[model samples]
Target: MKVTRTRLTEDEKKAWRQFCQASHASESEMLKMMIRKVSGSVSHTSARNAEPKSEKVTVRLAPGDFKKMDGRAQEEGYLSRTSWTTAVVLAALYREPVLTNEEVNALRQSCRELGAIGRNLNQVARALNIEFREGDRIKREAIEDLAERIEEHRALVFELLNKNMNRWRQ
Candidate 1:
């Protein structure tokens, strides 16, 4: 192993210690992640997918503890305890939420609705283009209504994102 050292001001050292504690990550792990990020060797998505699982870890919990964990997992919308544990671990490592199943479904539905609205807008634009070519008047109210619906959907998407992000906040 190669060793590298850097000096930090007292304030910087304090901040680093606090960050490591809050993230539930070892200093070595945090330093490795920072190095990868700074060197442009890893991106958020790539880092998450970089490792494939080929190992298993088994844990033995007391019956009461296991029941509590199972209940918490279900409450968080995880289909299984394993999935919930994975999400919690990844969230700590990456400092981001591993979205719940319900969150994923909600986002999927929103995207589908947005796609339909986009298709409708395209059809309206095509009709307007033809009208313009033939000197026919276009309906202003129809365009305005479509724009309003788009805005509403955009807001809903943002709201969902914010809610999901907050769900994992410590």
Candidate 2:
């Protein structure tokens, strides 16, 4: 055996700690196994089953459905539909709540609406603060309308969060 030394950044140190806790192995043992795997010096298998993979599954879908699935996966920042589908299926199997496409769309729309309302609110505030006294009454009425819209958007955000929270508990 040979001694090796290296430096790790703060983030790497944090990840190392997490890996150690999850893998239930000491640093030296884990590093040795990793080196062996990287160097192609060892083959891994379940202690009960030394045989390698032998099974595979294929899924079929309509072209349109596949396109939609791919679009949704990308919208959710997943690399591929397969990974997204796997995560959804695993969550379902574990009795965990996963958002449907409709729910995700609704959340996205709510975020956009809230952002627009906030911008309108800021514009109204700026208009009201301006020194031009000629349109004070009109600006006040517009501010009132914007305030009402902001409240409505806030309510929509709260409702969406409440609905998702309720669903997550199931």
Model 2, 32: alpha-carbon shift in Å? 36
Candidate 1: which pairs clash? Answer: none
Q: Which stretches of candidate 2 lie over 4 Å from their true place?
A: 1-98, 129-131, 168-170
Q: Which stretches of candidate 1 lie over 4 Å from their true place?
A: 1-69, 133-139
What TM-score, to 2 decimals, does candidate 2 have?
0.37
**TM-score for all predictions?**
0.52, 0.37
Per-residue lDDT of model 1, residues 1-170, tens digit only: 56678999997887676555444445666787778778987544423244694567688999998998899888877645776777777776887656764666676778888888888878777888778764344447567777888888889878877775665564
lDDT of 2 by residue, 59-149 (tens): 7899998897788677754544655676555555776434444455576677788788778777776776774684688677877887788
Candidate 2 has an lDDT of 0.63
Worst 10 residues of 2 by lDDT: 45-54
Q: Give the winner by lDDT.
A: 1
